[model samples]
Target: METIGKGGFCKVKEADVRVFRELLKKSTGERVEVTGMQHMAVKVFNRNVLKGQKTSEFDPFTGCLKMSDQLQSIMEEIKVWERNSNPNIVKIFKLYNDPTVPEMYLLMEKAQYGQIQIDLEGGDYLTKRNAEIEVVAVAKAGVHWPQGSGTDLEKASKWIFYQVAMAMEYLHSELKISHRDLKHQ
Candidate 1:
């Protein structure tokens, strides 16, 4: 078996880098490089391409889907660790994709530290020790650090619930926007 790196997946090699670059070129038509060891997660979408006008794919009033819509949806989500703007939110960043390989590449901010995944099958899994370590690390990293240092279990849980509620409230009370998937990983 291959040795697992700190990121949990198999160690990423030079070939992996090449493949990723190729994918980006094919998808967004841009040549880019992975600048650092930080985790800059990239998400690619396989949305339809229409040459003409853009239109809403779904009805605004009713939450329904239609088969006859001319436009197709191809949206991808890429999240990166950003400098801390808020204590409650971990980190968020914006990315730009290569226009040529538009579907393939999204160059994003890199987060030096890894992420913690909460398995939903069981109860809360983050131990106090881990929380304490993360808190201290963030504290030492300084408050103004643009790419925030870290987040604890309590903050993450609260943020998730709040974000979900706000999203739901927005859907019901504000403009209609469809979110196809909402998975943690």
Candidate 2:
């Protein structure tokens, strides 16, 4: 595994896992076996950061302050991701919790282009535009609607704005959650 990114409380690493595929029936009724290695991103949370923190923070969703701060935050994030089905959102494959381990692991889908923050820092104008386009494209790809073509920057900007607005609406109205820290990164 190789470290790809790191934040205050989490470190992201790139890893490959071998997965076995069962035999599948082909169109011609013949059995075919396939197996391959899948690339994934492992987000390891640093539990030490929450070691001495108070656990009595009030939770709006639960209407109670019963759970530990660390566990509450982790559970809330997992719940949000579990309820989210948006393609634009990074998918969480699995969560690992072990008694012996001090930290938790979240196995997630690897983004091909990487974080937008790094791309923007590279000073490429098209990188930001492409990132927005990619996000909008993924968000709208599942819907059955006629989407016009062309990579116009103005159009892309509008598309990105509208997509974000819709996502906010979904989170607020549908999921009853508010994202306080919203940023391009």
Candidate 3:
């Protein structure tokens, strides 16, 4: 697999065609061929970073006992993604756990435009301005928001803020959950 990105605790790779097919088959119980398919991003958590650590707590929302800090984080992320159907949030396709390995893989939709930080740094003036607008909108909404073009930043930012605020209100009031690490990225 070719490395596409990396973070402190995870590495994002361009999922290998063969491996992707195998994973899809395993996940869906159907043979899937990767022919002209959109590439999926595989986020592999570093085992070393999560080693020798565990946590157990009662989840107030799920009313179930959560175990292991790393495992809980992965499970919580998947749960949130599954519960939310917002267009602005990233979509998670599947979670792969190999018994032989300590690491876990998160199969997710690949963002075509890439990271916002890189875009802010290298993008044209308009792109940079739009990204800044998105950041401010997200902050105002207290959640994630989509970035786009061809509209006045003031009006577009307000709409983006409204959409994200509604989404967050739903997550908090209805789902009884919170995204503690909301950020521009």
The number of the candidate with the highest TM-score is 2
lDDT (10s digit) by residue, model 2, range 25-111: 222233222123267678888666655454565577789877575655776778787787766566786676554667777777777
Relative to the unseen true structure, what is the Cα RMSD of model 1?
10.5
The runs of at least 3 residues in candidate 2 whose Cα sits more than 4 Å from the true structure, single-residue gaps closed, are 19-37, 54-68, 119-151
The clash count of every prediction, one per candidate, is 15, 0, 0
Q: For candidate 3, lDDT tens digit of each residue in 1-185?
A: 87766665688988755678776688657554435446778889856566545867677889999777665565666787776666665567667666577778877777654554443433344233446645665566455444533344455567665766887887787677787656554
Computed on alpha carbons, the lDDT of every model, listed in order, comes to: 0.39, 0.62, 0.65
Candidate 1 or 3, higher TM-score? 3
Query: Residue-wise lDDT of candidate 1 within 1-185, one digit each (tens)?
Result: 11112121112122244565676579658665565433444433322332232545455568875443222322212221232333333333334533454243233333333333433433355422234334444455344222543444445455445655676555444433344544342
Q: How far off is residue 32 in model 1, in Å?
A: 4.0
How would you order the candidates by TM-score, starting with the best?
A: 2, 3, 1
- Comparing 2 and 3 by lDDT, which wins? 3
Per-residue lDDT value at 182 in model 2: 71
- lDDT, ranked from best to worst: 3, 2, 1
RMSD of 2: 8.9
